[model samples]
Target chain A: MTAHASPIGPGPTGPGPTAPPPAPPAVSPLRLVATLGISGALAGLLLVSVHRVTEPVIAAHKQRVLEDAVLEVLAGPTSYRTLYLVDGAFTPDLPAGADPRTLDTVYAGLGDDGARLDGFAIPASKPGFQDKVSLLFGWEPKDGTVRAIRVLESRETPGLGDRIEKDPAFAAGFVGRTTPLVGVKAGRGTGAPSEVDMITGATISSRTVIDAIDTTLARLRPALDAYAAEAAR
Target chain B: MKETTAREDLLRGIWRENPVLVQMLGLCPTLAVTNSVANSLAMGIATAFVLLGSSVLVASVKRLVPGEVRISAYVLIIATFVTVADMALEALAPGIHKALGAFIALIVVNCIILGRQEAFASKRPVGRAALDALGTGAGFVIALVLMGSVREVLGSGSFLGHPLFGAHYEPWVVMILPPGGFLTLGSILIALSWLRRRRAAAAGEARS
Candidate 1:
């Protein structure tokens, strides 16, 4: 195969008063292949080294952040346990042959007694105004109200759609609100049990948060109920 | 081309050829992550690390690379450094890493790093390349912080999460949104051009 000449070198010059530019040096195919191969190898080596060095630290950091989010959304529970959804049931153990990464897991925040359930911190995500909005919300099964919410990840439009995660009023509206919440115009909630005050300019993002929680709860509430009953027994 | 001194190489990117404001390179991260001061600072440092590392490596290996594959080689080198920076940021400062989000990984595609490698690092000596990287990195950081300060102060009524105004301050919400980035950058560019023109006129009058 003919070697592709470097574009950086001068192109073929037509005869002119100025002496024609010297012919570009021929690049050997082997050398070109070796250059790319060595670069690829070096890149692979560097990335591998960095990944090894940072893997544990990143994992620990993620775990810590997840724990903090769980606690914040669950309203400062003494501790929390990971419950995997298996066959429509919440079990503390991972299901056979199921990847933990792909499995749907919820955190059951425990009260001081270690056995009392404070609430369930359910993590959910849905496409928002700009990107997917991931959040964790504390669900009180007994009262059927959301306790609190923490936006774990979101790329909503800053200062506007991002108010879903930043605005205190928007978050406060979710606290103690009934399940399957309804999004209303900002400050137009009639103090109804299921009404949520959406950010004025971020209706899509606000609705996305509600939809994420409501859909997850709708799919998991039956299993959650079973799990709660099993725990009670 | 006139040969540049080390000091000139180190200082040019800060104002004369700034990667963000003056040259208008790397605007993706500039606009996306500059809504808050902390995020802007974190991204600037991360990008700086990648640029510096890639430039140094590219300069060192310039001879080894054939012209046919120079761009590919530079991209590989850049991607490596970007990955290293991304991993380091996630490990050392996960909160900032999270806030920066996909922008960290997206640094591999940032034109500033590659443009420097092709335009300066591949041709210059290692020391010169390093100086250029530092200058460009500093410029990028300065531009990001300037944008961040404006957006955060006006959009959120705070600076780095601290409220600059009293409780009554009403935030200009649009200032932190995407449009805010364009508006802020446009205003800064206009002001910079105006200042430059005024300085040029004064210099011309004195010379006359």
Candidate 2:
């Protein structure tokens, strides 16, 4: 049997152009797997390294913003101290009754000498028309009222609900208001002492803030009163 | 005295191929955050930072990325830069960060970043890719500012939060809402098309 008469056709292993292009030297399955694995590992390492570099700076910046928010809500305090609430009482240290997951952080603003109390800035949140309206509200027990309020986070409607932050009159109305705050229409007289004038187009957002302050204060009043008694001692 | 090709590459995005006006790539942010100048500027800067960083990274590592898996690799790289930008913005400028909110996080999915990566960066050198990304970013910012200014001035009678009109100037409430974004963009697109038609007509007249 000559070579041409063989049962099987000739498999041309030569570098001829017509030889099915040599199968383009297909990448081995192992090589493909290794390449993908290395690429993913490198990407992960890069992300981890970046996270490491930025983590501390980000944390520090957030702390600074929070501190600033405390001062802002308190109308610019000289110094501040963070207190934790547990079992209807405020304490310097985290209390045993305080749920680690939902512990309420209360910031005590101190005067220039750091002895006299300026006010307390407490964060609160409530659902608005669109989403949660997170805020920091300042309270002074001496006045039996809220000192000021600063929006910490809000996803209110752009032109309407956001007016809670944008409108000066609406924000100013929050200051010096008593607990159990109420939100009313802009032109409608705040018939009661604890009422806030809602932004013209942002009744829901305004009510969200007022209701949040009222609810948060109702929950914290006992702790604040207890703290006041402890201070008197 | 001029480098024509480089200049063309840089300026092309501004008018000829604006990511917003002409190309219409990143309309999600273009429409969503253009309510006020402040928000639009913040979003633009954040998006630009992500785009520029991702373009450079993708260009540098393009060769290593396998063709079949390149899209995934590019997306991962883009997401990494976007997260870094978002974190940096939140830490450095919390107010603007808050105002920008999820839009900052949404930069990861902005087609402008991914488009640049898939179309230009992966095929070019790092320097060129970065320049292209910068041009595109600047164009995006300009477009955002235009929309923002129109919306803010008309809707709120303010520019950059400062009152631009007198007390008697009644704000057009629609300009600042979602519809206002569409209106402003639509007007801008119409104006652009008109100008283009005029230019084309003039060129045709000259040829005739």
Candidate 3:
């Protein structure tokens, strides 16, 4: 009976040895680290590849959009050249510019032949009702008057402040407007080249654009005049 | 009976478990970008692309990931696709890109895509995962377009930028504002719930 019991016990226990033991309670440090590292590396590789492939395309598209804006403001120039403002002076490249760089960009519109100077498209930015109001406007240096204006970027309110771009009548007021610009209430009579009728609701945003254009034009007028003369000669 | 048919898996997200209306995920962009139809369309397409790509990639690689770092892994994968989508949109459609602005980059944090990766895609085969992603994405698009149409038509008195009302018609100015998003969504939810209740009652009567 004892021998039989022993044989039975051993037979029952034999199957347990063949069955797989439970996995370790925790993942080994090496395996965990390796897994994370591999996942990270794969993700990094994918991002890098996408960035590399799309970088040039994105840059080119941005350049094209800016060019289109310039054309619209400058009344359809055939070509344009970007000049940079560095340390109170203009330069074509950044390497040769001074350390305290303003890096302001001015686009000089060229005529159909691409040789004669047409006008200048200068970008300007200033605080608005909500945020920064940045825009590009064409300058006819001969008359020292703004040809046209297009908002490049703005973060004003949707219905009111956003009227700066949405209201074509308001934007139309900028065409042929002279500098030292001032914004008054809409529907007010336009008696002066410097006076502009602000949007009915968006006084601050309208004022922001008018003031920014005025200040920027005032500062850059001399340099712009000199550049235009040089290009014409 | 526990697992659904492939067709059901493909169709479920469109209505039964919609990412936006039913699941109530990814509302930030829904409210922000649906101010206009064009913006809504662009945002929806961009989101769909990101969702589909991330789901497929995650489904294919689910087994290799350890449970401990799975969330981080999923985020890393999702972020990669978001970056790709952002760059692709910027390159291909600059106007849309400019209109959508940072919301395109914000797609990475959209809970719907990450939720799918964690809950459904990680457990399913790649084919089924993709189908689910597509359904969910289509549902999101439908919801956005619905809201966009309503807002654009009522707020601006236009449909997709075309004037639907005469000059004398005054638009509901509140419809284009942020509060309008909340009001429209609330009304839609109420209407959907009412329809659902009516259907349930009819089904119960039939069973009786």
Candidate 4:
């Protein structure tokens, strides 16, 4: 192998022209088995130790991020009450009022001390270019004006569609808008009372954000009216 | 214990054995995190730190790793270093830690680290293995940074969040999307192939 490698017409430079390196002497199977056993045990030990130490911190950060998003939607004076949606109509849960798991959602924000501040709808689904546009929306108690829109997850193309998640201007539009499938007009900003600016070159993205808001708002308004009527009575 | 050839361990990883452009290892970070020079730099250094730690530990214990279960054992070792990296990043730079998201934990699957231990580190002296790991890590960083800078400049009209081109330069919206990553990487590969052919032709002329 050494003699063959020495010179093969000026020695191979490219991978196609080059020769494989000389093979090293082989060892016995028993030795290989012992080596594997020891390494496996040691590596497993180190991994578990590290995971135990870091799990808390990782979990805390994740929790904090979610809390912050929820709170942002529930802004102003607030309290979070767990509600059971028994049959998809803001109803309560399983085990007979044991905080229904099958269809329960977190109804957030009363007042400084259980006073009525506002109500929010947590609408989560995969849509748009990347298939994960999770959002939290706060609608005012009456008229369903949008108070805020919080993006939880999205994988849209940066600059174009990602503007939905990152651009303050695009998000600022979501605030103060009243609902029903109305995407902000292309190019120039729409001068309507409930309108936001569409991204300059992302028509598909603009439509997605509008559709998400529209769908969420459509379901929310009727339920919100029912809740309002319940409160009045 | 017998030692492996240093030249084989070194040059193999740099080109024909590259961890990113050639080997196509660790595509998640290669695409998601490489959006800017700053992001790429942060990811690169984090990766290099983990590679160094894991290579040392894996090589030291190579004699004991069972051949039948080496793959599982290698993942265990790699995961530990990745956790250490995650912890350090969280403590020192919480901002970057959030920005990186699951990519930090995803490093557990990064083929560069495991590929080194399985192919080179476990079979070689500790020092030579470290050098090979460093070379491969460094090459990956360079490729990531290059890819990120190209996208940031063309897509967002910024460089590390700073403006390089004036407002007159219209942003190429497609450059920051998923397709943009593939686009830039493809063109770069073509350019690299072209350069190699030009260099090879030059060499042949001199020889003749």
Model 2 B-chain TM: 0.94
Stronger candidate by DockQ (1 vs 2): 1
Give me candidate 1's TM-score against the actual structure. 0.82
How well is each residue in A9-90 modelled by candidate 3, as lDDT tens digits? 2122110122222334687778778988998898889888988999999998877788899988998787987777765555
Docking class of 1: acceptable
Clashing pairs in 3: none
TM-score of each: 0.82, 0.76, 0.83, 0.74
- Per residue, candidate 2 scores C-alpha lDDT tens digits across A38-82 of 767876787788788878887888788788788888886868888
1 versus 4: better lDDT goes to? 1
For every candidate in turn, the CA RMSD to the true structure comes to 5.9, 10.8, 11.0, 6.5
Which candidate, 3 or 4, would have the higher TM-score against the true structure? Answer: 3
Off by over 4 Å in 1: A1-24, A75-77, A92-102, A110-118, A127-131, A142-145, A154-164, A167-208
What lDDT, from 0 to 1, does candidate 2 have? 0.78
Model 2, range B1-208, lDDT digits (tens) per residue?
A: 1233556656776666677777677888999989899989988888888888888988897766666666777777777777778777776777788777788878877877776776677766788778888889999999999999999999989999999878888889888778888889989988987998999999999999
DockQ of 2: 0.13
lDDT of 3 by residue, B1-208 (tens): 1476678777877877776777677778888889788889889988889989999998998777777777788888888888889988888888889888999999988877876776677778999889888988888888888888888889888888889988877888788888999998889888988998999999999999
10 residues in a row with least lDDT, candidate 1 chain B:
B16-25
Q: How well is each residue in A64-133 modelled by candidate 1, as lDDT tens digits?
A: 8889889988986869999999878888998678899888999998989898877999999999988899
Give lDDT: candidate 2, residue B93. Answer: 79
* Better model by DockQ: candidate 3 vs candidate 4: 4
Better of 2 and 4 by DockQ: 4
**Candidate 4 structure quality by residue, lDDT tens digits, A1-233:** 01122232222221222222233346577766766666657666776676677777777876677677766876664455544444545542344546343453545556666745356646545478867687776666576677777776787776578878888777777787776536656546557766667887777776787777777656555665676566546
